[model samples]
Target: MERWVGKVAIVTGASAGIGAAVVEALAKQGLIVAGFARRKERVEELAKKLQGAKGKLYAVKVDVSKEKEVIEGFNWVKKNLGPVHILINNAGIIRNNTLIDGNSQQWEEVLVTNVFGLCVVTREAIKSMKENNVDGHIIHINSRSGHRVPNIPNINVYPASKHAVTALAETLRHEITRNNLKIKITSISPGYTETEIIEAAGLPKNNYKDIPAIKAEDVAEGVLYALGTPPHVQVGEVTLFAVGDKS
Candidate 1:
């Protein structure tokens, strides 16, 4: 944490939920944070509230699903905030449809945003880190679904996309190791987090209310725990779940 003070960090899906929480936590730690999301206004509002904090916050309009927008956002950060020292790939989505008889568009949307979007952001961020000789850290906001399929229904390809994330984290680590790069990659998987994502996925509001769930802030705390480790310590993965959650 002390070493990261005055450094730059980029957090995707930062308009709200876990991403927003992470942004606020890092800013308080004196790290310049760039919040990237399509809902630029929301992040702008958050930035205003974070004024006078130990660090600063900037809002960047970006839809990680769009390659061009991702590239532009990274370029802007490099030009204004210098090289990226940390990247939190927190953008993800879940559609209400079953793979047995689901809409192709919905499936594509999940894959594009959850899988492809993460890859694009990682690539661009790594490029900046390498060119600048920064030993950056990349954290993926994965889900319990990434490790195993949940018992929930109509999740469609959401779990599949997350499973891909599980693989991506390992693949990126291997790639970095092969090149002898000091960059670190980690995957943080949380189970049934209380966020708008569940409602947006078309689940009944009561469904989440009745279940044991972790707050978005709890997950943010996990992010800080990972980032605060010693330089020689690389946390490969951190999985969190509510105590009451059976699975």
Candidate 2:
């Protein structure tokens, strides 16, 4: 059975990397997928490709960091496609700078985009989910940096925000449990994967052999796996490291 058939899903950062992979995977599973990104060109191209292939997909231009845009994006999905049954808070940014050398703007950008953006999207999406009394699933693409910062003292802000995300995910899980909203939430901690973000970070391009980088599709598979489980069954957390990227 198609796990996402008839379900509507929202994937942020869908223009590239794991975000794109997740959108593509969900669409292939028969979900009505909405792809959101700040720059619409790539997402639009992906949507056109999906449409041409007779797949269910929609592309929306949004900067997830903006509250109004986040609200409008999810509302658009609800009104046009359907209530969002799934949300992948996959939009994030990385800043490779040390405490003293780091740009203040970069710090703000990292926190606002990775943390605040997540909150806005989740809040609006949950409003719709709760109003409809639907038990939906939210998957956050967090990083291992959340758990243990790399030895490299640079990239401080990136890890700090990710750590916040890790804590936020756990706190949300607890809150939802106590309130009995029945919504399922989980976070996946992924080590270095071959993506544009890494390349932008000045990492090598897609060389997994040395460090064991996982593919974006690998993360997408995890999302689908989580979505497939029965509501009563929840995978609280999943941590994936490329086989050789050892912890």
Candidate 3:
């Protein structure tokens, strides 16, 4: 397989967790990476970690959920790294609450970050890519909850947001096809993963263990595999569930 020797890629939420892992994976393959996140210090540390890798990594701070910031971040990447050849809309926030307990804040935060952020980033990327006439590839990191019930109560907003990702990815693929653009878009849905997101949710580390929950690296590997395919071949959708997950 041909490696991303001179390709430019952008990963949102690269400050940590799955986004960080995705940055590292692409960097090892020699893709110039623009790591976008709101956390300056952590994103800088991630860039430093990738410094020893084959590819060059640049960190930018932006709140992806905000349209202005998203536009600015992508513009910065274009100015500094050239047009993006690949994009991973990996920035996401998860909030758990039942209908009764879930206030508007919890619902709004998850929806805005997961859904609106993805849209904002992708819109900017498509605009830049079209301007540059670059045939780009997009990978969306969705979740298993988007497909089936996890048998857990509450967490309605998180699942709802992920479901929207799944739907949006599929719809975007067709739009690309209709436009006759040489672009590929795919979505990878992961089951419970061991990441800071889960930790922040107050779940025990690796607690989704009826089947061993996947690691951030596992999802990252999935993205790498999708991107590594031949340009003519597109891996449309991948749903990765835990080993023992009935859903």
Of the candidates shown, which would achieve the greatest TM-score relative to the real structure? 1
Better of 1 and 2 by lDDT: 1
Instruction: Return model 2's CA RMSD, one decimal.
Output: 2.2
Clashing pairs in 1: none
Query: Who wins the lDDT comparison?
Result: 1
Error of 1 at 209 (Å): 4.5
TM-score of each: 0.98, 0.93, 0.94
Error of 1 at 151 (Å): 0.7
Candidate 3 stretches with Cα past 4 Å from truth are 1-3, 203-211
What digit string (tens of lDDT, one per residue) describes model 2 on residues 31-64? Answer: 8888989978998888777874424878998999
Q: Cα deviation in Å at residue 24, candidate 1?
A: 0.4
lDDT of 3 at 162: 88
Question: Which 10 successive residues of model 3 have the least lDDT summed?
Answer: 202-211
Pairs that clash in candidate 2? none
Please say which candidate is ahead in TM-score: 2 or 3. 3
Ranking by TM-score: 1, 3, 2
Instruction: Please write out the lDDT profile of model 3 over residues 114-186, one tens digit for every residue.
Output: 9999998988888888888988899998888778657665566788788899899989988898999888899
Q: Write down the RMSD of all candidates, one decimal each.
A: 0.9, 2.2, 1.7
Q: What lDDT does model 1 reach? A: 0.94
